[model samples]
Target: MTIDLEILHALSEAFGPPGDESQVRDLLRGRLAPLTDEVWTDVVGNLFALKRAKGESRGRVLVTAHMDEAALMVMQVGGDGLLSVRAAGKTEARGLLGQVVHLGPSRTPGVIGVQPVHLTPHERRQDLPDLGDLTVDIGVDSKDEAAGVVKRGDYAVPAAAFGRLGPLVKGKALDNRAGLVVALALLEGDYPCDLYIAFTAQEGVGARGARVAAYAVEPDLALVVDGVGVDELPDEDEPPPDVRLGEGPVLVLSDTRTLLDRGLSLRLQALAEAHGIPYQVLATRGETSDARGVQAAGAGIPTALVGLPIRYPHLPVSLAHPDDLEAAFRLLQAALSQPG
Candidate 1:
């Protein structure tokens, strides 16, 4: 199946920071309602779409894609109209300086500001600035004015556009949006097992929504569709990245918090190879995803992770290869079609 550009554009451009995923959830729910038998959400904001098996169910199968992205939260509004912020998840202070952001539910425009490098002390100039050294300037002149636009505890996301760059797709939050597109596509096919699609929330924070959704669904097998990062620099050295754009979808072996089901991972790899779909493997021990929570829930679920490699992940805008995106969809479709 080809990628749905309209859905990809909508999901990529929607603002859905950790713990605040209504925008993304709404998009998925509307698309999934017509394709699934049931669509519902939990109190913590996780969206679930279920499509029953065609006949006797082989088993309950679950596939998930998180709805949240790295973001910033306003900690305080300074008297000068600047907003002090803390990272909500994977937001990096180094990438935020001077970056444009949309704040709160209103999507008020703002730009992150930092002290001029030319005026900073020489010794401190080389030091990396932390979140404390940054402030979001909302083009206001007083705290009251800023308060009228934004306030303490409001969330902000990168103000970025979604578009294709040659063979690459560039946009904010491609990390999980790419996965969402695949998960949405899977709903189009009728599988042999009860299929559950979870558009999880708060994944960037700590996979909070995934934990609850896993326990609720209690699928015999779980697969996490998400984004993995690439380390393909022009001059990059040893410990080279195992994942890369255009290469294929990633079959994650292990990450910081989760060790994927080896049998499930191997089955996916075999399917990809047998079907002529390109695929890759990643074993980074420092990275994590919703599988972290899903694998440990309810006596244990056999969980596997399929990832689309992203460039400049967790930044304002990231890049992904459209081919990799399609490969992921094709592979997961094959996996779901197999009789367990």
Candidate 2:
């Protein structure tokens, strides 16, 4: 299968954060409208595209991916041109010391500020700054000046561009953007069932968008695609992540809070085995996925999570392999080529 790297690059670099997905939503709407018979955005900002079957419809299949990424939101502007910020998703303040963010719709450039290490007492140098203590510097000299360029509730995301880095694609928001691109690729194939492609919102803070979409669609089967990064990686001091990058798409059996439908999960594995698609079993114990909301809606629906492992997850520089991306697209295409 020939995967389109250009789509990945565009999506990875798009400006999107939790509770604010208009930028990414516009991009998806334009790209998906021509491919499907119907495309529209719902009340919660979830974008849905539907393509009907050629003949008699067997069943409806809903494939979903979240478009929102973790980011920083402006809370207050200080008198000294300092913009106070907070995490928009699960992103931490530790590795964000020297990061850059583009503020609001204007995309004004700014940097997260910190005290220079040279001035710190030698005994207290190892201490990390709290997220609440960090501020964004937008090159202004006073609070009113800074307010003219930025206001409270303005969203800021890392000013990272998606590009090739040796063997992997690197940029911000690879976690779920990678999955969204893969889902879009599946539209190229024909299927016996009617297909619904949902680009959901607010998945970083919680599965808020997926919850409403699942209930609204009410399909017989649902598949959630995620590009969640590994919690920990293999190293001299730490054990390997439960799932590894470049291996294949992950067939999520269960997450920290939800037990996915066994029948569907096993069916995906069977299809992968039959098609010679390299796959992995992700039994993560610390992170919750969109499955929680999808599986618990109304009378309960069968669901499975098709995941791709990202290197840094929520940071501005998440990395993913092209091989794994193709595997995900092919697996979804072949699995639903005929309805189960």
Candidate 3:
């Protein structure tokens, strides 16, 4: 199947930060409508696309990719029009300083503010700025002016642009958006069982959407697509040693929060080897995806995880190899086509 680079680029740059996923939902709905038999959405804003198999019945298979990204929420507007924000999810405070962010609906632009280096005394130069002290400046003069354009509860996300750096794509939300792209690409092809593709919400927080989507779909088997960190920086001290970019998709043996399905893990590995898709094994001490929530839902659905290797995860700029995304797409497509 041919990859739609335009859709992929748009998806990577779409604005959706946790509880506010409407923008991305709209784009996904438009793209999946033609490929799916029935498309619907859950109350919590999870997008579900269903495709039935021909003739008799086979159990359903659920494929999920989270639609939310790490973000900040406006807590209060200071008297001087500086907006104080509360960090949402696992956001990096260090990466936030001096970064441009986008506010809700109106898409108002703001820049994270930091103390000028020239004004900092020598002794305080080594200190990292605290989240409480940081504010977002949108060029308003007072609280009333800022309030007219943005509200107290509005969400904020990094102002990211999608572009390719050689063979790799760099953007903000690729963590799971890349996975969403893979799910859409797979849907463009045929598979054996009935499929339920759920673009879930609030994954960075607690995997809330995955739980609800799993209960609603009730699949015999579930596969989660997401991004994992790769050690690419030179000065990094013995990087996570789990996954790396350009090594295809990483199959999780275990993560800090969940142990993978042993049988499913082995089968995925065998499938990758047989198909000649580049793959790597990743065991991490502190990472979890929507797969954890899916496995614990209801009577305990059998689950597996397919992760794209990412650089600088949870930051404003995250990186991934396009070939790794294609590998993940190939792997999941093969898995879904096989009999259980």
Candidate 4:
């Protein structure tokens, strides 16, 4: 269940918005071709791989990890070379101000901008700028000049480069990219059930890719692996929560979209304890993952969520511990190496 940090870093930095996931999928396709019995992409760009069971046949097990990142799309360009943008997913507009964004497949660079504080109204000095008032600057003089390299409906994401920072890894798209790396590790595991690993698209938008992939696979059991942020609020604001950066993976019981199956989650917890793999129960809420759409598919499919605790999940410098990711990979490999 160990991961190659170099490959994981590349996956985190690769550009792929909700609908435009070709770049990320291409890299995954290359890596999976050697390890899987069959690897292919669906109409919606979800990457599915199969590792067939050898002897006795068990049910299909779908393990999902989203490929899309929280990003923005170009809405319109202004006469002043500034571009208006729209959210591609549940984008955190507040975190976007003054951040660098990469545009399109070429990775063209741009910066989200707002008026300087000196020009703002005195009463508004302490308030954050509105997303509606924001614009992207690509250094062109006018709208016509900007059209040479930019266009409407292009994808924009945080210009985050991957690297190790002390004991943590910082990069963009860690929310689900961490899950993608964990899923890749399973390709090297001993599969007791027929494993169908899905690197889903459009999860940042609405889990659109997961819904379509689930209908196609129709597995008896599924697991959605995603990254959850560690609460970093000051103690004065609230007492510290159990979630921590260096802690092992977070075992999620429920989220905003669906309440995960308790029996499956308990089984994972019991396995963690028996193997002495450090883990913590996720105490945070108000989040969702691809598991929601998959669990509600035709005839109903039971699913659970495994979380990799991260900090500043959607911002430019999202942070995660490598140990947490390794833990997640090991726990899942062990889970799938048994009968469903």
Candidate 5:
């Protein structure tokens, strides 16, 4: 399958932090409009595009790719033009320190500040700094001056530059954005089953958008695409020791919230082997995806989870192999073409 690097680049860089998904939705709407028969955006801002099956509906198949990434909300402008922020989701403060962040509307740029090492006391130097102790410097001198240009509640995210790093790509928001790209690619392909491509929102917060999207579509089969944590350490003693980057996409068996359907799991494994698509088995101890909330949507929807093998997931610089993305796209395309 030919991958569209342009689309992937655009999606990865687009701004959409949980509830604020309009910008990303607009980009997807334009790209998917020509490929799909119908396109609609729900009240919760979940973008759904449909390609009707040729004959009687075997069953609705929902493919979801979350549109939200970890971010921070501006809590207050400090007395010295510094911005105090509260975590919007599961972001680590250490990863954000010394990183550039983009503020709302005008796209104001700011750098996260930490006390200089020479000024820090020896005892406190080794301790990790808490979020409350950090501040964002936007080059202004006073809170009154800062307030003139920036406002409270504006979202802030890593202003990381996007580019390929060897075989892996490094960038912010690659976790779910890469999955969104895969879903759009599937929509643009020729699949046999009725397909609903749902670009969900608020996945960083309990898969809220997915819950509503699944409830609305009521699909017989649902596939949630996102990134899964992979161990890249030289030593093999990490908590999740099974998965690795460049191996392939993961067929998640179970996570904290849901387990894969037994029949679906076997079918996916068989399909991968028959088509020569690389795959790995994942057992997430605490993580969960939209699949959990989606499966419980009405009576119950059979669900499967496919994830790109990502290192340092949920961090600003997530890593994913291009081959894994292609493998995922192929699996979904083939599964939809099969008799349901």
Candidate 6:
């Protein structure tokens, strides 16, 4: 499977900060319209593209990839003119220092202001600043001036351009946008089951959109497309972790919030091995994903999480390999082509 760089780049660069996901939604809507039998959005803003079964319906299958990215929300417009902001999702405070952020619908650019290291006390130099202690410099000097541009509750995202770095793709929001691209590719296929591809919203804050979506779709079985953390650094002395970039898409056995279906996990692993597609597995304990809502919806939906392992997840800019993304698409395509 060939990964579409154009679509992946567009999704990665789209401004979708949790509650405000219209930009990402609209982008997906246009692409999905021609590929599916029907396209629609639910109340919670989960965009659905249905590609009905070509012959006798085997069962209903739901595939989801979150549209929202970690962001900062403006909390106050201080009299001093710098806007106070807080994390809207799992944004890392340590990564926020000196990074540029685009605020609200206008996409007004701002830089997170950090105290100069030279001016800071020695002990405090290594301290990470809380979200409340940070300010965004949008080039204004008064509360009245700042109010004219941005207001409280407005969302902001880190500014980063999407591009390829040799085998790796780098950009903000690849945490799930890589998954979005995989889901998009899946939409082109005609499956044995009635396929519902959900471009879910507010996943970064929680698996909020998927909860409503799963109830609405009522899929018999499901597959969650997401991105997982890759914890490799060149300077680290320890042995490398099992999950790594360029390896392949990850088949998550279990995570903090949800225990994935065993049958589905085995099917994915077997399919990958049979087809000679490279793959990896993870049973990480700390992080969670949209699978939390999806697997638990409507009594129960047996769901599996297939993740694209990415470096620097939840940060302003993340990195992934094109081959890994393509492998993920192939694995999913293979799964849907076969009967449940």
- Which candidate has the top score in TM-score? 6
Candidate 5 lDDT over 68-141, as tens digits, reads: 88888899998988899988766778788788888887779999988889999999888888887778899999
lDDT tens digits by residue: candidate 3, 59-139: 799999999988999999999999999877668788888999999688899999888989999999888877777899999
**Model 6 TM-score?**
0.98
TM-scores for the candidates: 0.97, 0.96, 0.96, 0.97, 0.96, 0.98
Clashes of 3: 0
- Candidate 5 — which residues are off by over 4 angstroms? 236-240
lDDT of 4 by residue, 189-296 (tens): 767789999999999877889988998999989998988878776778687877888789898888887888888988989888888888888744787889888888
* Candidate 6 local lDDT, 93-210, one digit each (tens): 8788899999988899999998899999999988888878999999999999988799999999989999989878999999999999989988877888899999999998779999
User: For residues 57-144, could you state the per-residue lDDT of candidate 1 as single tens digits?
Assistant: 9999999999999999999999999999999978898778889999998999999876798899998878878887788999999998
Better of 2 and 5 by TM-score: 2
- The superposed Cα distance between candidate 4 and the true structure at residue 257, in angstroms, equals 1.8
**Cα lDDT listed for each candidate:** 0.90, 0.86, 0.87, 0.87, 0.84, 0.91
What TM-score number comes out for model 5? Answer: 0.96
Q: Any residue pairs clashing in model 3, and if so which?
A: none
Clashing pairs in 2: 175-227
Which ten contiguous residues of candidate 2 have the minimum total lDDT?
228-237
Model with the higher lDDT, candidate 4 or 6:
6
Question: Candidate 5: which pairs clash?
Answer: none
Q: What is the lDDT of residue 294 in candidate 1?
A: 93
Let me know the TM-score candidate 2 reaches against the reference structure: 0.96
lDDT of 3: 0.87
RMSD (CA, Å), each prediction: 1.2, 1.4, 1.5, 1.3, 1.5, 1.2
User: Of the candidates numbered 1 and 2, which has the greater TM-score value?
Assistant: 1
